[model samples]
Target: MSFPEDPIACMRSLQAEFGDLAVLEEKGQRIAFVFSPELNRRVLTDPTNFHSRFFAVRGGRRSAQRRVTSGLLSVNGSEHRDARRIMMDVFAKKVLPQYHETIVGMTSDLMADWQTGQLHDLNEEMVTFMVRMTGALLFGITDGEYSEELGTRIDHWVRQNHRVGMGALVAAEEYTSQYEQLLQMADELEVSIQDMFRRHRQAGNSAQRPDVLSLMFRAQGTERELSDEKLVGHATLTFAAAHLTTAHTLSWTLFLLAQHPDVAARLQQELDSCTAAGVPDFAELQNCTYLDWVIKESMRVLPASSYSQRVAVAPVTLGPLNLPAGTPVIFSQFMTHHRGDTFADYARFLPQRWENAKPSAYEYLPFGAGSRMCIGASLAMVELRTILAVMLRKWHFQIESGATVDGRVIATMLGPTSSVPSRLIAADQIANTVPVHGSIHDLVELPSEARTAVVRRAA
Candidate 1:
C-alpha cells in the first residue's frame, strides 16, 4: 500500500500500518510482510521449505535473472549448506581474527591521508576505502594492479545501483543502466579475483596465499569448488555485499555522531579512555564498549536492508496468519528494531539502550536472524570497531551546517544519496582532551607501558 518513491519514506509507512504483519500487494501479487520478531525467528530458522527465491527480480525478465541467483547468497539446500561449511573454515572465528592487523593497517592508512575541514562525499570516500580493504584482505587482489581501477568502478556502480527505483522516469533509464553496470562491475571484480584463485590453486605452498583465496582452493580440494562461473558469481557477491554494507553502516554511524554532539563527546571520552592515541592494537579494539553500542544503535536505527525475504514452498501457519504455499515472506529489521514496546523512544539515537538491554532472538537483527544470518557479522564488528576507533583517535568531525543526512536503498544495502555531506577535524587539532577508557571484552586496550611490558616479557 505504501507507494512512496523514497525508500526511507516507504519503510516508515510500512512500519506504521503493520505492527507484526502486512501483505504488500502490487498488481494482484501479495507478498507477505512479517514484522514480528517471533515470526521472523520461524522464517529464518526453518530453511527446509522457506528458502530464498534467488531468481526473483523486480520488473524484470525472469529468464535472464536465473544466472544471478546461482551463487551462495541465492541458492539453498544441501549444496548451500556444504558451501557454507567450507566457507566457515575461511571466514571462521580463528581466521577472521587474523585480519585484524590488516584491517587496522588499512584504516590507519586511509585516515592518515584524510583532509579535514572540507565537504567530502562520505559515501564515495567510504566505498573507496572499503573496496581497497576488501581487495587486499578478502579477495586477495594485488594493490598495484586493481586499487585505482576498483575505486573508480565501485563509485560508478554505487551511484548506478542507487538510481534504480528512485522514480518513474529515473527508474526507466537508470535501472537498466545500473543493473548492467552492476553485472559489469561483477565481471571486473571476478577477473581480478580469478587471477588470485588461479595462483593460489597452482601454488604448491599454502603459506603464500592470503587466507580467503586459499580457503577457496581448499574448498575446491574437498570437491566443494564452485564452477568457474559460480566462482565468479560468488566473488561478485562478496565484493558487492562486503563493500557497500560496511560503507553504509559506517556512514550512518558518522551521521549519527554528527547529529548528536553530546553523544559524540561521550564517545570521544570512551574512545580516549579505551584506546591509545595512535593506531589501534587488538586489545584496544576489544576494549571499546561504548563504540560497540554506538555502532549497534546506528544499525538499529537504520539497518542496511530494511526487509529480508524467503519464499514459502509449503503452506504454514505463522501465529495468527496462515500463509499459503508460494507466499513470499518478508521481515523488516528496521521495523523490528524500532518497536517502541521493546525499545525506549524507538525513534531516538540512543546507544545507552543497549548498555543493559538485550532484545529477544529476532527483535534486533541488524544482521538477519538464524543460520542464514550474515557470515560477515563478526568480521563486520571487528572492522567497524577498528575503523571507528582509529578514526576517532585521529579525527573529530561534524556535519556541515544545513545538511541533512539521507538514505537510499541500493540492491541489498542502504547508502547516502549523491550529495550527502560532512566536515571533519583531525583529532590532534581538536581542543578537547578526553581519556578513552572502558571494559575489555574479547579485545583489550594496552597503554604504552603495557606494550613495553609485553615486549619485554616476550623477550
Candidate 2:
C-alpha cells in the first residue's frame, strides 16, 4: 500500500468514497483500513486475533535502542499484564494532586519569559513545556535545565525514529543511511537514564518518592521483576506517550480558542467563576464543566493520533471480508471523529456539542480505547486543565494575520508542520479571529465570529 502524500486529507477522501471499510494490497500481503466505531470496537476488542504491533523494525538484539523502544506498548500477554499492574499505582487518582502542584509550578516557570505583547512560536513553546512537565512527572527531577537536556535528547531521538521508520517501510536507502544516527542518540539516552537511576538511588527514601520512575523502582525485586533493560523501556515509553500528545493537544486547543473568540471569552468566564485568584487547583478544575467540553470538542475535531496500526495474528473474518494472518490493519480516529452520521455539524468547531452528547468510548477516543489505551491519560487531563487555566487567565492568544497554519500527521500524531507564530493579547482585551493562510482550513471549519453559528440550533 502506498502512503499518500497528504494522509489526513487522503483518509478523509477514502472514507467518503468507500463507506466504512477499505482494503489495500501491500505487495502480496493485505492491509485492512477500517473507519467506523463498530469496526474499531471489533478489531480492538479482539486482540487475540489482532496483536498490537506498532512497527516492524527493531534496532538490534542487545542494543540500548531496542531495550528502550520495547516499552509497555510493545509487550503483550503476561509481561504486559504484570507491567500494567505495577505501573497502575503511579497514575492512581489519589496521587493526582501531587502531580497537579508540579504541573502548576512548571507552567509558571514556562510563562516566566512571556510579556504582554510578545510574539512566540506557540507550538514550539508547548512542546518544550510538555517535555519539562513530563520529566518532572517521570523522574522527580527539580532542576529545570537538566530536565530539559534529557527531554530534548529523547525528543530528538523520537523524531529520528519516526522519520527513519517511515523510510524503512518502503526500503528507502536514504532513510536507511540515518539508521546509525538514531542508535547513537539512543546510546546517549541510555546513559542519561542510568545517571537518573544513580540520582534516584542516592536520594534517600526513594521508595516513598511518587514519580513514575521512583514507584517503578520500588516495584523492582517484587513478584514480577523487571530487568534494567526493560526499565529503560518503561521510562522512555511514559515520556514519549505523555510529552508530544499532550503538547499538541494544548497547541490545538489554544489555537481553536483563539479563532473562536466567543468560545474563548465564554470559557474565560467559566475559568473566572471556577478558579481562585485566576489559577484553578485540581478541585476548581473539576468544576469547570465548560472547560471540559472545550478540551473534549477540540480533541474530537483534531485528534492528536490520527490512526493506529495493528497486525492480524490469526486468520479472521471481518464482516463480509475474509483476511489471512499477518495482515496489517489500520483504524483511523480522524475518520471516526469526523463522521457526520455520529456528530451533527461535525465540521464546525463547536464546544457546546459535548454538553448533552454521550458518545461511546470507541466513538470519542483521543487517548484511544481498548485495553492498551494510553497509560498517562489521567495525568494528561489534569495537566491540560492546569495549563489552560493559568494561561487563559493571564492572556488572550491569537495567530498573526496572514500566517500560514498547517497540520500534518507524523509518527501517528497530528500537529502543526511549522511554527504557529502568535501574538499574546492582554486579558482585558477582546480577541478577534485573524486571516490564516494554509491547510488548517482543510481539517477545521473556521468561520468569522460575525457569521458563526452553534452546532445545536437551540444554542
Candidate 3:
C-alpha cells in the first residue's frame, strides 16, 4: 500500500487495515506499527525489550545530518540514567519555584509590544515568545534579536527535514551547507552560554542563578558531570525541544479557544479569580483547575509529537504478535488519543472531561509515560500555565474570518498548516467591541487588504 499523504490518516489507515499490530516492509526492513494502548505501554515503558536507539536515531538524523554527540535523548543504559540524574535538579520542583519571576518577566516583555487591533500571526507570535523564553531560561540570553536569529536558524534546520518520498533520501552532501550553518549557530550559542557562565563565576553569583547552564556548571564535579561536548548536545536539544513543542501547544490552544468563546470566557474568569497579581506563581497556577484542563484538552486534540518509535533490542511479544530483534515498532499518539474507548465524544473539545475522568498514562500519552518520558515536561507545564494565564488575562484574540487553521505534521510535531491570522484586542475592550458570548466569527471584521494578505500568505 502507498503511504498516505497525511501522517495521521496514514496511521489510522494502517491500524484499520492490520488491526492492533501492523507489520510493513519498507526498503527490505520489517517495521511493526502498534496501535493498542497495551502494546504502546510495553514499547514505551519496557526500554530493555524495546530500546530507544531507534527513536534517538530518528531524532538525531535531522535533514540527513547526523548528531556529533549523544545527549540524554540518544543515550541509553547507565549513561542515560546518569545524565538524567544530573540534570534532574535543573527542572526539579525546588528550582522551578525560583524561575516563576523570570518566566513572567520574559513573557511580559514580549507582550508589551502587542497592540490592540493589530493583526498578528498567532503561530509566529507564539514562536517568538517561546524563542525568547527558552533563550533566557536555557542560556540566560535576553537579547531579543539574538534569540530571534537563533530561533530562525533552528527553524531552517528543522524545515530541511520536512521532505517526503525520494526527496527525503538525498545524499548527505545535499544537507552539508545547512547542517554546517546549524553547527555554526550552535557554536555561537555555546560560546554565549560559556560567557554567561564566566560572568556568573566572576561575579560570585553562579550558584544563585536558576538557569540551566548555571545548574550544569554547578554540577560539573558531581556524579552527573557532563563534558563540554555533551553540554552542547544537551543544550541544543533542550532549546529545540522545549520551545518548539510548547509553542505549538500554545498556538493550538489559542486556536481552539477562539473557536469556543464560552470556554475562553470561563477560562478568563478562572484566571482572574485565581491569580491575584495577574502573573501566577506555581502554586497559584496549580489552583487554576480550568486553565490546566484547557491546556490538557488542547494537547489531547493536537499533541506536539505525532508519534514515537522504539526498536526491539531482543525478541519481544507485543500483544499477540512476536517481534524479532532489529524490528522498529511505532506508536502514534495522534490516532490513539482520539480513540472512542478512552474518551467520551473523543472528537469534541471538552475541558470538562478532565474534571472528573482520570485516564491512565498509557491511554493519554501526551508527554509519554516511562523512564524516557520528556525530561523537560515539568518546565513545559510551568511555561504553558504561566504564559496562558498571562495572555488570557491581558488580551483576547479573534481569529480572522476566512482564515483556515488546521494541523500539519512537520518534522514529527503537529503544527498549524498556515499562519493563524488573528486580531488582538485588549481583554477589557472585548466587552465593548464584541459580546463576551459572541462567536469569534462575529468579533473581527478584517479589511479587504488584510484578508488578501492573510490568504496570500496562507497560499
Candidate 4:
C-alpha cells in the first residue's frame, strides 16, 4: 500500500489491516513495519542484524554530515559498545544533579520573560527555551555565547535534516537537491562542535565543568577516550536528540493538561503540595507520583519521537515476510502505545492508565528500548519534571478557543506545525478545556465536548 502526506494516518490504517507486521514498497524498495512488542523486541534486541541507519543519503564515506550524525543511534557493534561505555559515565546518576541545576537555572531564565494574560505560541516558546537549555547542558552555559552559537548551529542543522530526510521516505528527487544544503549545515555544525572542544580543552576546567562536553573531555586520559571526531558526532547528536523532542513534550503536556482540566487540577495540587517556591528538588520530584503519571501519559499519547527505522544487516524474516539484507524496517511508538488490546481506551489522554498499567519497553517506548535506548532518558525526565513543575506551578495556561493547533512528523519527531496560541494565567487560576481544531486530531484522540474529567486519589 502507498503512504500519504500524513504517514501517521497511514500507519494507523496499516495497524488495523495488518495486526502485527506489514511490508510495503516505496520507490522499488521493500520497507518492513512491525507493531507488536514481540516484533519490537526481535528487531531492537539484535541490533547486529538490524543496524540503525537513519539517513537515506549519507553524502560520502568521509562526509561531515555522516560523521556528525554517527553517534550511538547510527553506530553498530563494537563502536556502539565502546561509545556507550564511555558515554555512560557522562550520563550517570551522579552527573544528573549538576545537570538538574542547569535545567532549573535555564528554566528560571525562560520563565522570567513571562507576563500574565500575555499570549504565546507555546511551541515557539518551548522550542526556543530548549535550545538554550540543551546548549547549557551540552556545553558550558557560563560563557553563553558559545552555547547559543553551537546550539543555534545544531538546531538549524537538525531542522534541515528533518525537512530533507523525511522526504527521502518517498525517494523524492525534490529532496535530493537539498541534501547538499543539509551537508553544508553539518559542515558548519561540525566546526562549532570542534571549536567548543578546543576552548573547553584550553581552559583546563574539564574536571570542574559539569556540562556534557566538559565531562566527555575530562574522560580523555582513559583507554576508552573518544577521538575528536567521535566527540563531534556525540555532541551534535546529543543536542539534536535533546532539543526539539523535549520542547514538544513540554508543549504537548501543557496543551493536554489544559484540555483535560481535572487532570490539570489534580496535577496542580500535586505540584503545589510537593514543590517549594515553584521549583522541585530531585527528592521532591520522586514523591510527585501523579505528576509522573501525567508526564508518562503525555508521552504515551503524543510522543515526540514517534517512529524510527533500522536497516537489516542480514537476511531476516519479520513475521510472515522475508526481508533481504540492507532492507529498512520500521517500529512505531505511537501505534504501539495506542493498541486497544494493549491499553484499554488507549486513544484518550488518561494519565490514570499508568497508575495500574504495565507494558513492556517495546509496548510503550517513548525513549525507545533495547541497547539503543536514549542515553539522555534520565536527564530528559528530570528536565521535563523540573520545567513542567516550575512553569505550571507559576502559571495556569488556557488555550485560546479559536486557536488552531497542528502537529507534523518530521524525521522521527512529532512537533507542532502551527503556533499553539495560549494565554498565561495566574497560577492560582483554573484552566479549562476549550474546543479546538487541527491536524493534532490526527495524532491524539481528544474529547468531542468540553471535558471535565476529574482524577481523585484513594487514601
Candidate of highest TM-score: 4
What is the Å distance of residue 44 in model 3 from its true position?
1.3
Report clashes for each candidate as comma-separated counts. 10, 1, 0, 0
Task: Determine the backbone clash count of candidate 1.
Answer: 10
lDDT of 1 by residue, 38-118 (tens): 878888889987987533432243322334335567678886897677667777777766787788777877766577676
lDDT value for candidate 4? 0.82
Per-candidate Cα lDDT values, in order, are 0.65, 0.81, 0.71, 0.82
RMSD of each: 10.5, 4.0, 6.0, 4.5
Off by over 4 Å in 4: 1-4, 142-148, 162-169, 202-204, 450-459
Tens-place lDDT digits, model 2, residues 1-459: 245356677676667787788775544645678899999999988877888765455688998888878887777767777888878887888878877777888888778888877998889988878887888889988787888898888878887886686565545577778888999988999998888888878886876665778778777868457777788888887887788899899999998888888899899888888898855778989999999999989999999988887888888998898888877788888888998888998978899998788998888788878988887888889888889998888888867876777898887889988889888887766578877766787788887541232222225
Tens-place lDDT digits, model 4, residues 1-459: 245366687787777897789877776867778888899999999987998876555667798988898887777899889999999998988778787777777778877979998998899988877877887788776665656677778777777776676566567677657888998988887887788777767878677777888888777668455878888888888888898889999999999988888898898888888888656887888788999899999999999998998988899887777899978888999888888889988878999888899998889899999999999999999889988887888888899885668898766788898999899998888877776767777677777643222111111
TM-score of each: 0.80, 0.93, 0.84, 0.93
Model 4, C-alpha of 338: deviation from truth (Å): 0.8
Displacement of residue 453 (Cα, Å) in model 4 is 19
Lowest lDDT sum, 10 consecutive residues, model 2, at 449-458
Question: Sort by TM-score, best first: what order?
Answer: 4, 2, 3, 1
Clashing pairs in 3: none
Q: What value does the lDDT take at residue 391 in candidate 3?
A: 80
Per-residue lDDT tens digits for candidate 3, residues 61-145, read 4422334235566677787888888888888877887778888888788788888888989888888888888887887766778
lDDT of 2 at 250: 93
- Compare the candidates by lDDT and give the number of the best one: 4
- By summed lDDT, the worst window of 10 consecutive residues in model 1 runs over 434-443
